[model samples]
Target: MATTAVINGERLWSALMAMAEIGRTPAGGVRRLALSDEDRRARDLLVEWLREAGCAVRVDDLGNIYGRRDGDDAGATAVVCGSHLDTVPTGGRFDGVLGVLAALEAVRAMRDADLRTRRPVEVVCWTNEEGVRFAPAMLASGVVCGRFTVDEAHAARDQDGRTFGEELRR
Candidate 1:
Protein backbone atom coordinates (compact mmCIF):
# COMPACT_ATOMS: atom_id res chain seq x y z
CA MET A 1 0.00 0.00 0.00
CA ALA A 2 1.26 3.46 -0.86
CA THR A 3 1.22 6.37 1.56
CA THR A 4 -1.76 8.64 0.99
CA ALA A 5 -1.10 12.32 0.39
CA VAL A 6 -2.69 15.29 2.06
CA ILE A 7 -6.12 16.34 0.82
CA ASN A 8 -6.38 19.80 -0.66
CA GLY A 9 -8.07 22.06 1.86
CA GLU A 10 -9.14 24.49 -0.84
CA ARG A 11 -10.85 21.75 -2.74
CA LEU A 12 -12.66 20.49 0.32
CA TRP A 13 -13.83 23.98 1.17
CA SER A 14 -14.99 24.47 -2.40
CA ALA A 15 -17.01 21.30 -2.29
CA LEU A 16 -18.67 22.42 0.93
CA MET A 17 -19.59 25.74 -0.56
CA ALA A 18 -21.03 24.13 -3.66
CA MET A 19 -23.14 21.71 -1.70
CA ALA A 20 -24.29 24.45 0.68
CA GLU A 21 -25.84 26.37 -2.17
CA ILE A 22 -28.58 23.85 -2.49
CA GLY A 23 -31.71 24.74 -0.48
CA ARG A 24 -29.93 27.66 1.14
CA THR A 25 -32.37 29.75 3.14
CA PRO A 26 -32.47 33.54 3.25
CA ALA A 27 -30.84 33.62 6.65
CA GLY A 28 -27.79 31.62 5.50
CA GLY A 29 -29.37 28.45 6.81
CA VAL A 30 -30.27 25.25 5.00
CA ARG A 31 -33.88 24.23 4.39
CA ARG A 32 -33.36 20.93 2.65
CA LEU A 33 -35.83 18.19 3.42
CA ALA A 34 -35.18 14.52 3.08
CA LEU A 35 -35.81 13.38 -0.48
CA SER A 36 -36.58 16.87 -1.71
CA ASP A 37 -35.08 18.54 -4.78
CA GLU A 38 -32.60 20.37 -2.63
CA ASP A 39 -31.50 17.16 -1.01
CA ARG A 40 -31.12 15.51 -4.39
CA ARG A 41 -29.08 18.40 -5.65
CA ALA A 42 -26.80 18.27 -2.64
CA ARG A 43 -26.30 14.55 -3.07
CA ASP A 44 -25.48 15.08 -6.70
CA LEU A 45 -22.82 17.58 -5.79
CA LEU A 46 -21.27 15.14 -3.39
CA VAL A 47 -21.29 12.51 -6.09
CA GLU A 48 -19.41 14.82 -8.40
CA TRP A 49 -16.79 15.60 -5.77
CA LEU A 50 -16.34 11.96 -4.94
CA ARG A 51 -15.76 11.23 -8.58
CA GLU A 52 -13.26 14.05 -8.79
CA ALA A 53 -11.49 12.52 -5.85
CA GLY A 54 -11.17 9.24 -7.78
CA CYS A 55 -13.59 7.36 -5.58
CA ALA A 56 -15.87 4.75 -7.06
CA VAL A 57 -19.30 5.86 -5.97
CA ARG A 58 -22.57 3.98 -5.55
CA VAL A 59 -25.99 4.67 -4.18
CA ASP A 60 -27.62 2.07 -1.99
CA ASP A 61 -31.22 0.98 -2.33
CA LEU A 62 -32.12 3.42 0.45
CA GLY A 63 -30.39 6.28 -1.39
CA ASN A 64 -27.30 6.38 0.80
CA ILE A 65 -24.27 7.70 -1.03
CA TYR A 66 -21.11 5.62 -0.76
CA GLY A 67 -17.67 6.58 -1.99
CA ARG A 68 -15.08 3.87 -1.89
CA ARG A 69 -11.31 3.82 -1.82
CA ASP A 70 -10.31 0.26 -2.46
CA GLY A 71 -7.87 -1.29 -0.01
CA ASP A 72 -5.00 -3.66 -0.63
CA ASP A 73 -6.80 -6.49 1.10
CA ALA A 74 -9.85 -6.99 -0.97
CA GLY A 75 -11.38 -9.43 1.52
CA ALA A 76 -10.87 -7.26 4.57
CA THR A 77 -13.73 -5.39 6.16
CA ALA A 78 -14.07 -1.79 5.04
CA VAL A 79 -13.17 1.18 7.23
CA VAL A 80 -16.42 3.07 7.15
CA CYS A 81 -17.42 6.62 8.04
CA GLY A 82 -21.08 7.56 8.00
CA SER A 83 -23.07 10.77 8.17
CA HIS A 84 -26.15 12.37 6.65
CA LEU A 85 -26.72 14.92 3.92
CA ASP A 86 -30.30 15.82 4.71
CA THR A 87 -30.89 18.92 6.79
CA VAL A 88 -33.74 20.43 8.79
CA PRO A 89 -35.95 23.29 7.59
CA THR A 90 -33.77 25.83 9.34
CA GLY A 91 -30.65 23.86 10.08
CA GLY A 92 -27.41 25.73 10.18
CA ARG A 93 -24.26 24.74 8.35
CA PHE A 94 -21.42 22.67 9.84
CA ASP A 95 -23.53 20.10 11.62
CA GLY A 96 -23.89 16.91 9.62
CA VAL A 97 -22.18 18.47 6.63
CA LEU A 98 -18.85 18.66 8.41
CA GLY A 99 -18.70 14.96 9.08
CA VAL A 100 -19.58 13.98 5.55
CA LEU A 101 -17.19 16.49 4.04
CA ALA A 102 -14.41 15.55 6.40
CA ALA A 103 -14.68 11.94 5.42
CA LEU A 104 -14.58 12.92 1.79
CA GLU A 105 -11.56 15.08 2.37
CA ALA A 106 -9.76 12.28 4.13
CA VAL A 107 -10.34 10.00 1.19
CA ARG A 108 -9.15 12.75 -1.10
CA ALA A 109 -6.04 13.12 0.99
CA MET A 110 -5.28 9.44 0.71
CA ARG A 111 -5.55 9.62 -3.05
CA ASP A 112 -3.46 12.74 -3.31
CA ALA A 113 -0.77 11.22 -1.14
CA ASP A 114 -0.98 7.99 -3.13
CA LEU A 115 -1.38 5.95 0.03
CA ARG A 116 -3.49 2.84 0.51
CA THR A 117 -4.57 1.00 3.63
CA ARG A 118 -5.14 -2.69 4.12
CA ARG A 119 -8.83 -2.10 4.73
CA PRO A 120 -11.07 -0.37 2.27
CA VAL A 121 -12.25 3.10 3.24
CA GLU A 122 -15.81 4.13 2.60
CA VAL A 123 -17.40 7.51 3.05
CA VAL A 124 -21.13 7.10 3.52
CA CYS A 125 -23.90 9.63 3.56
CA TRP A 126 -26.92 8.26 5.36
CA THR A 127 -30.19 9.41 3.88
CA ASN A 128 -32.65 11.47 5.93
CA GLU A 129 -30.53 11.76 9.05
CA GLU A 130 -32.37 14.91 10.02
CA GLY A 131 -35.92 13.54 9.69
CA VAL A 132 -37.09 17.12 9.31
CA ARG A 133 -39.13 16.16 6.29
CA PHE A 134 -40.21 12.85 7.79
CA ALA A 135 -40.78 11.19 11.13
CA PRO A 136 -37.94 10.13 13.39
CA ALA A 137 -34.28 10.39 12.45
CA MET A 138 -31.51 8.25 11.02
CA LEU A 139 -33.38 6.23 8.46
CA ALA A 140 -30.82 4.96 5.95
CA SER A 141 -28.28 3.75 8.50
CA GLY A 142 -30.99 2.25 10.71
CA VAL A 143 -32.52 0.35 7.83
CA VAL A 144 -29.18 -0.77 6.40
CA CYS A 145 -27.89 -1.98 9.75
CA GLY A 146 -31.21 -3.83 10.31
CA ARG A 147 -32.27 -1.53 13.12
CA PHE A 148 -35.49 -0.74 11.24
CA THR A 149 -37.30 -2.16 8.26
CA VAL A 150 -37.83 -0.21 5.10
CA ASP A 151 -41.58 -0.27 5.47
CA GLU A 152 -41.42 1.17 8.97
CA ALA A 153 -39.29 4.05 7.85
CA HIS A 154 -41.39 4.69 4.78
CA ALA A 155 -44.51 4.89 6.90
CA ALA A 156 -43.07 7.86 8.76
CA ARG A 157 -44.66 11.23 8.13
CA ASP A 158 -43.42 14.73 8.75
CA GLN A 159 -45.19 17.65 10.39
CA ASP A 160 -46.61 18.50 6.97
CA GLY A 161 -48.27 15.08 6.78
CA ARG A 162 -45.92 13.78 4.12
CA THR A 163 -44.66 10.24 4.20
CA PHE A 164 -40.96 9.48 4.09
CA GLY A 165 -41.13 7.71 0.79
CA GLU A 166 -43.40 10.38 -0.61
CA GLU A 167 -41.13 13.20 0.43
CA LEU A 168 -38.12 11.28 -0.83
CA ARG A 169 -39.54 10.75 -4.26
CA ARG A 170 -40.42 14.45 -4.41
Candidate 2:
Protein backbone atom coordinates (compact mmCIF):
# COMPACT_ATOMS: atom_id res chain seq x y z
CA MET A 1 0.00 0.00 0.00
CA ALA A 2 1.04 3.53 -0.72
CA THR A 3 0.83 6.30 1.78
CA THR A 4 -0.22 9.87 1.02
CA ALA A 5 0.51 12.99 2.96
CA VAL A 6 -2.62 14.77 4.05
CA ILE A 7 -2.65 18.53 4.25
CA ASN A 8 -4.68 20.53 6.77
CA GLY A 9 -7.68 21.51 4.75
CA GLU A 10 -9.04 23.83 7.39
CA ARG A 11 -5.85 25.86 7.54
CA LEU A 12 -5.65 26.06 3.78
CA TRP A 13 -9.23 27.19 3.56
CA SER A 14 -8.66 29.86 6.16
CA ALA A 15 -5.62 31.18 4.34
CA LEU A 16 -7.54 31.28 1.08
CA MET A 17 -10.38 33.19 2.65
CA ALA A 18 -8.00 35.69 4.18
CA MET A 19 -6.28 36.29 0.86
CA ALA A 20 -9.61 36.70 -0.92
CA GLU A 21 -10.31 39.70 1.24
CA ILE A 22 -7.29 41.62 0.01
CA GLY A 23 -8.72 42.98 -3.21
CA ARG A 24 -12.31 41.94 -2.78
CA THR A 25 -14.99 43.75 -4.76
CA PRO A 26 -18.66 44.26 -4.16
CA ALA A 27 -19.25 41.93 -7.10
CA GLY A 28 -17.48 39.18 -5.16
CA GLY A 29 -14.40 39.23 -7.36
CA VAL A 30 -10.82 40.39 -7.08
CA ARG A 31 -9.44 43.68 -8.39
CA ARG A 32 -5.77 43.01 -7.94
CA LEU A 33 -4.72 44.13 -11.39
CA ALA A 34 -1.02 43.69 -12.10
CA LEU A 35 1.19 46.28 -10.38
CA SER A 36 -1.74 47.93 -8.68
CA ASP A 37 -1.76 48.89 -4.99
CA GLU A 38 -4.07 45.99 -4.32
CA ASP A 39 -1.64 43.69 -6.04
CA ARG A 40 1.18 44.99 -3.85
CA ARG A 41 -0.86 44.33 -0.73
CA ALA A 42 -1.56 40.84 -1.93
CA ARG A 43 2.12 40.26 -2.58
CA ASP A 44 3.05 41.66 0.80
CA LEU A 45 0.62 39.31 2.51
CA LEU A 46 2.02 36.32 0.67
CA VAL A 47 5.57 37.31 1.54
CA GLU A 48 4.59 37.65 5.17
CA TRP A 49 3.02 34.21 5.13
CA LEU A 50 6.06 32.73 3.39
CA ARG A 51 8.33 34.22 6.03
CA GLU A 52 6.10 32.84 8.73
CA ALA A 53 6.62 29.41 7.15
CA GLY A 54 10.39 29.87 7.70
CA CYS A 55 11.25 30.52 4.07
CA ALA A 56 13.77 33.12 2.92
CA VAL A 57 11.96 35.48 0.62
CA ARG A 58 13.35 37.66 -2.20
CA VAL A 59 12.08 39.83 -4.99
CA ASP A 60 13.81 40.12 -8.33
CA ASP A 61 14.41 43.22 -10.41
CA LEU A 62 11.35 42.36 -12.40
CA GLY A 63 9.31 42.03 -9.20
CA ASN A 64 9.00 38.26 -9.18
CA ILE A 65 8.97 37.04 -5.58
CA TYR A 66 10.65 33.82 -4.42
CA GLY A 67 10.44 32.09 -1.07
CA ARG A 68 13.06 29.43 -0.50
CA ARG A 69 13.18 26.58 1.99
CA ASP A 70 16.67 25.34 2.63
CA GLY A 71 17.48 21.65 2.45
CA ASP A 72 20.27 19.61 3.99
CA ASP A 73 22.42 20.08 0.93
CA ALA A 74 23.49 23.66 0.40
CA GLY A 75 24.95 23.22 -3.06
CA ALA A 76 21.95 21.66 -4.76
CA THR A 77 19.73 23.73 -7.02
CA ALA A 78 16.30 24.49 -5.69
CA VAL A 79 13.10 22.78 -6.78
CA VAL A 80 10.76 25.60 -7.73
CA CYS A 81 6.98 25.62 -7.60
CA GLY A 82 4.57 28.53 -7.81
CA SER A 83 2.09 30.66 -9.69
CA HIS A 84 1.36 34.33 -10.11
CA LEU A 85 -0.28 36.61 -7.54
CA ASP A 86 -1.42 39.20 -10.04
CA THR A 87 -4.93 39.06 -11.41
CA VAL A 88 -7.25 40.48 -14.04
CA PRO A 89 -9.31 43.63 -13.41
CA THR A 90 -12.09 41.48 -12.04
CA GLY A 91 -10.63 38.05 -11.47
CA GLY A 92 -11.97 35.16 -9.46
CA ARG A 93 -10.51 34.28 -6.09
CA PHE A 94 -9.07 30.98 -7.23
CA ASP A 95 -7.57 32.09 -10.51
CA GLY A 96 -3.92 32.58 -9.55
CA VAL A 97 -4.24 33.18 -5.83
CA LEU A 98 -5.03 29.55 -5.09
CA GLY A 99 -1.81 28.29 -6.65
CA VAL A 100 0.29 30.80 -4.72
CA LEU A 101 -1.49 29.99 -1.45
CA ALA A 102 -1.26 26.27 -2.09
CA ALA A 103 2.49 26.52 -2.58
CA LEU A 104 2.74 28.51 0.62
CA GLU A 105 0.65 25.91 2.43
CA ALA A 106 2.85 23.09 1.18
CA VAL A 107 5.92 24.88 2.48
CA ARG A 108 4.18 25.48 5.79
CA ALA A 109 3.19 21.84 6.05
CA MET A 110 6.73 20.73 5.28
CA ARG A 111 8.05 23.00 7.99
CA ASP A 112 5.54 21.64 10.46
CA ALA A 113 6.67 18.10 9.63
CA ASP A 114 10.36 19.04 9.87
CA LEU A 115 10.95 17.54 6.45
CA ARG A 116 14.21 18.03 4.65
CA THR A 117 15.35 17.20 1.14
CA ARG A 118 18.60 17.24 -0.81
CA ARG A 119 17.59 20.37 -2.71
CA PRO A 120 16.02 23.59 -1.56
CA VAL A 121 12.39 24.25 -2.49
CA GLU A 122 11.28 27.62 -3.84
CA VAL A 123 7.85 29.10 -4.19
CA VAL A 124 7.63 31.84 -6.76
CA CYS A 125 5.09 34.55 -7.45
CA TRP A 126 5.52 35.60 -11.04
CA THR A 127 4.67 39.21 -11.84
CA ASN A 128 2.32 40.48 -14.51
CA GLU A 129 0.93 37.07 -15.25
CA GLU A 130 -2.52 38.43 -15.96
CA GLY A 131 -1.22 41.18 -18.27
CA VAL A 132 -4.36 43.11 -17.44
CA ARG A 133 -2.41 46.24 -16.66
CA PHE A 134 0.58 45.33 -18.77
CA ALA A 135 0.53 43.52 -22.08
CA PRO A 136 1.79 39.99 -22.88
CA ALA A 137 1.19 37.71 -19.90
CA MET A 138 3.86 35.68 -18.13
CA LEU A 139 6.27 38.59 -18.29
CA ALA A 140 8.37 37.72 -15.28
CA SER A 141 8.72 34.06 -16.16
CA GLY A 142 9.64 35.00 -19.67
CA VAL A 143 12.40 37.23 -18.39
CA VAL A 144 13.67 34.54 -16.05
CA CYS A 145 13.61 31.88 -18.79
CA GLY A 146 15.50 34.15 -21.22
CA ARG A 147 12.59 34.35 -23.65
CA PHE A 148 12.29 38.08 -22.93
CA THR A 149 14.90 40.56 -21.83
CA VAL A 150 14.59 42.38 -18.51
CA ASP A 151 14.50 45.71 -20.28
CA GLU A 152 11.66 44.56 -22.50
CA ALA A 153 9.58 43.41 -19.59
CA HIS A 154 10.29 46.62 -17.74
CA ALA A 155 9.30 48.75 -20.66
CA ALA A 156 5.86 47.19 -20.91
CA ARG A 157 3.18 49.77 -20.29
CA ASP A 158 -0.29 49.56 -18.88
CA GLN A 159 -3.49 51.17 -20.13
CA ASP A 160 -2.68 54.31 -18.17
CA GLY A 161 0.84 54.63 -19.67
CA ARG A 162 2.57 53.45 -16.53
CA THR A 163 5.61 51.25 -17.11
CA PHE A 164 6.05 47.88 -15.48
CA GLY A 165 9.48 48.88 -14.23
CA GLU A 166 8.16 52.09 -12.75
CA GLU A 167 5.45 50.31 -10.82
CA LEU A 168 7.84 47.60 -9.69
CA ARG A 169 10.14 50.24 -8.27
CA ARG A 170 7.34 51.73 -6.19
Candidate 3:
Protein backbone atom coordinates (compact mmCIF):
# COMPACT_ATOMS: atom_id res chain seq x y z
CA MET A 1 0.00 0.00 0.00
CA ALA A 2 1.17 3.53 -0.75
CA THR A 3 0.57 6.48 1.47
CA THR A 4 -0.02 9.95 0.11
CA ALA A 5 0.92 13.20 1.81
CA VAL A 6 -1.23 16.19 1.11
CA ILE A 7 0.25 19.60 0.38
CA ASN A 8 -0.80 22.52 2.54
CA GLY A 9 -2.52 24.64 -0.01
CA GLU A 10 -3.55 27.30 2.46
CA ARG A 11 0.03 27.84 3.49
CA LEU A 12 1.15 28.04 -0.11
CA TRP A 13 -1.56 30.53 -0.98
CA SER A 14 -0.74 32.69 2.00
CA ALA A 15 2.90 32.77 1.05
CA LEU A 16 2.05 33.73 -2.50
CA MET A 17 -0.11 36.54 -1.27
CA ALA A 18 2.65 37.84 0.97
CA MET A 19 5.15 37.76 -1.86
CA ALA A 20 2.75 39.43 -4.25
CA GLU A 21 2.53 42.34 -1.85
CA ILE A 22 6.24 43.03 -2.18
CA GLY A 23 6.12 44.38 -5.70
CA ARG A 24 2.46 44.96 -6.07
CA THR A 25 1.07 47.22 -8.79
CA PRO A 26 -2.07 49.32 -8.78
CA ALA A 27 -3.54 46.91 -11.32
CA GLY A 28 -3.05 44.01 -8.85
CA GLY A 29 -0.03 42.61 -10.66
CA VAL A 30 3.69 42.49 -9.96
CA ARG A 31 6.43 44.89 -11.03
CA ARG A 32 9.50 43.14 -9.69
CA LEU A 33 11.87 43.70 -12.53
CA ALA A 34 15.26 42.01 -12.34
CA LEU A 35 17.53 43.50 -9.68
CA SER A 36 15.17 46.31 -8.89
CA ASP A 37 14.61 47.45 -5.30
CA GLU A 38 11.30 45.64 -5.38
CA ASP A 39 13.05 42.49 -6.50
CA ARG A 40 15.52 42.84 -3.62
CA ARG A 41 12.67 43.22 -1.14
CA ALA A 42 11.04 40.11 -2.53
CA ARG A 43 14.31 38.27 -2.25
CA ASP A 44 14.70 39.40 1.34
CA LEU A 45 11.24 38.16 2.18
CA LEU A 46 11.94 34.79 0.60
CA VAL A 47 15.21 34.53 2.50
CA GLU A 48 13.40 35.23 5.73
CA TRP A 49 10.82 32.58 4.96
CA LEU A 50 13.50 30.09 3.98
CA ARG A 51 15.28 30.71 7.26
CA GLU A 52 12.05 30.27 9.18
CA ALA A 53 11.59 26.93 7.47
CA GLY A 54 14.98 25.86 8.84
CA CYS A 55 16.71 26.01 5.49
CA ALA A 56 20.34 27.01 5.23
CA VAL A 57 20.19 29.93 2.87
CA ARG A 58 22.89 31.59 0.81
CA VAL A 59 23.21 33.98 -2.07
CA ASP A 60 25.58 33.28 -4.91
CA ASP A 61 28.11 35.60 -6.48
CA LEU A 62 25.60 36.53 -9.14
CA GLY A 63 22.91 37.14 -6.48
CA ASN A 64 20.95 33.94 -7.04
CA ILE A 65 19.43 32.81 -3.78
CA TYR A 66 19.52 29.21 -2.55
CA GLY A 67 17.82 27.45 0.32
CA ARG A 68 19.06 24.02 1.31
CA ARG A 69 17.63 21.28 3.50
CA ASP A 70 20.16 18.73 4.51
CA GLY A 71 19.44 15.02 4.33
CA ASP A 72 20.64 11.98 6.25
CA ASP A 73 23.76 11.53 4.23
CA ALA A 74 26.20 14.41 4.17
CA GLY A 75 28.23 13.07 1.27
CA ALA A 76 25.30 12.59 -1.07
CA THR A 77 24.75 14.87 -4.01
CA ALA A 78 21.97 17.45 -3.71
CA VAL A 79 18.65 17.23 -5.51
CA VAL A 80 18.12 20.74 -6.76
CA CYS A 81 14.86 22.36 -7.79
CA GLY A 82 13.50 25.87 -8.23
CA SER A 83 12.72 28.77 -10.56
CA HIS A 84 13.27 32.46 -10.92
CA LEU A 85 11.61 35.04 -8.62
CA ASP A 86 12.29 38.06 -10.81
CA THR A 87 9.43 39.28 -12.99
CA VAL A 88 8.75 41.56 -15.92
CA PRO A 89 7.63 45.17 -15.64
CA THR A 90 4.01 44.13 -15.47
CA GLY A 91 4.02 40.41 -14.85
CA GLY A 92 1.36 38.32 -13.19
CA ARG A 93 1.65 37.38 -9.55
CA PHE A 94 2.37 33.75 -10.21
CA ASP A 95 4.70 33.85 -13.17
CA GLY A 96 8.02 32.67 -11.70
CA VAL A 97 6.82 32.95 -8.11
CA LEU A 98 4.90 29.69 -8.19
CA GLY A 99 7.90 27.51 -8.83
CA VAL A 100 10.03 29.08 -6.11
CA LEU A 101 7.22 29.06 -3.59
CA ALA A 102 6.36 25.48 -4.48
CA ALA A 103 9.91 24.47 -3.73
CA LEU A 104 9.70 26.23 -0.37
CA GLU A 105 6.44 24.50 0.37
CA ALA A 106 8.00 21.14 -0.39
CA VAL A 107 10.74 21.80 2.11
CA ARG A 108 8.26 22.93 4.68
CA ALA A 109 6.13 19.84 4.10
CA MET A 110 9.13 17.60 4.52
CA ARG A 111 10.02 19.31 7.75
CA ASP A 112 6.50 18.97 9.04
CA ALA A 113 6.49 15.27 8.27
CA ASP A 114 9.97 14.71 9.68
CA LEU A 115 10.97 13.22 6.36
CA ARG A 116 14.62 12.80 5.58
CA THR A 117 16.14 11.49 2.39
CA ARG A 118 19.65 10.53 1.37
CA ARG A 119 20.24 13.58 -0.76
CA PRO A 120 20.03 17.21 0.22
CA VAL A 121 17.25 19.25 -1.36
CA GLU A 122 18.12 22.65 -2.70
CA VAL A 123 15.69 25.36 -3.79
CA VAL A 124 17.05 28.10 -5.97
CA CYS A 125 15.72 31.57 -6.76
CA TRP A 126 17.40 32.37 -10.05
CA THR A 127 18.23 35.97 -10.85
CA ASN A 128 17.30 37.94 -13.97
CA GLU A 129 15.11 35.38 -15.68
CA GLU A 130 13.01 38.20 -17.11
CA GLY A 131 14.92 40.42 -19.53
CA VAL A 132 12.81 43.49 -18.92
CA ARG A 133 15.32 45.16 -16.62
CA PHE A 134 18.43 43.42 -17.83
CA ALA A 135 18.88 42.15 -21.35
CA PRO A 136 19.72 38.48 -22.05
CA ALA A 137 17.51 36.54 -19.70
CA MET A 138 18.62 33.76 -17.40
CA LEU A 139 21.85 35.54 -16.70
CA ALA A 140 22.63 33.82 -13.40
CA SER A 141 21.97 30.35 -14.69
CA GLY A 142 23.99 31.11 -17.80
CA VAL A 143 26.99 31.88 -15.63
CA VAL A 144 26.43 28.87 -13.39
CA CYS A 145 26.18 26.42 -16.27
CA GLY A 146 29.14 27.84 -18.17
CA ARG A 147 26.94 29.24 -20.91
CA PHE A 148 28.22 32.74 -20.11
CA THR A 149 31.18 34.03 -18.23
CA VAL A 150 30.55 35.78 -14.92
CA ASP A 151 32.25 38.90 -16.23
CA GLU A 152 30.11 38.90 -19.34
CA ALA A 153 26.88 38.46 -17.44
CA HIS A 154 27.88 41.05 -14.88
CA ALA A 155 28.66 43.53 -17.59
CA ALA A 156 25.10 43.52 -18.88
CA ARG A 157 23.48 46.91 -18.35
CA ASP A 158 19.91 48.02 -18.06
CA GLN A 159 18.30 50.79 -20.14
CA ASP A 160 19.34 53.27 -17.44
CA GLY A 161 22.99 52.20 -17.86
CA ARG A 162 23.21 50.43 -14.49
CA THR A 163 25.26 47.26 -14.68
CA PHE A 164 23.84 44.03 -13.39
CA GLY A 165 26.90 43.62 -11.21
CA GLU A 166 26.33 47.03 -9.62
CA GLU A 167 22.71 46.35 -8.85
CA LEU A 168 23.61 42.97 -7.43
CA ARG A 169 26.08 44.59 -5.07
CA ARG A 170 23.48 47.06 -3.78
In model 3, where do residues sit more than 4 Å from their true spots?
1-5
7-74: candidate 1 lDDT, tens digit per residue: 68898788777777888889998877788888888888889888998889998767889999999999
RMSD of each: 1.8, 2.4, 1.9
Who wins the lDDT comparison? 3
Candidate 2 lDDT score at position 93: 84
Q: How do the candidates rank by TM-score, highest first?
A: 3, 2, 1
State each model's CA lDDT, in order.
0.83, 0.87, 0.90
Candidates sorted by lDDT, descending order?
A: 3, 2, 1
Reference-based lDDT, residue 91, model 3: 90
Clashing pairs in 2: none
Please report, as a residue range, the 10-residue window in candidate 2 with the lowest summed lDDT. 1-10
Query: What TM-score goes with each of the models?
Result: 0.90, 0.94, 0.95
Better of 2 and 3 by TM-score: 3
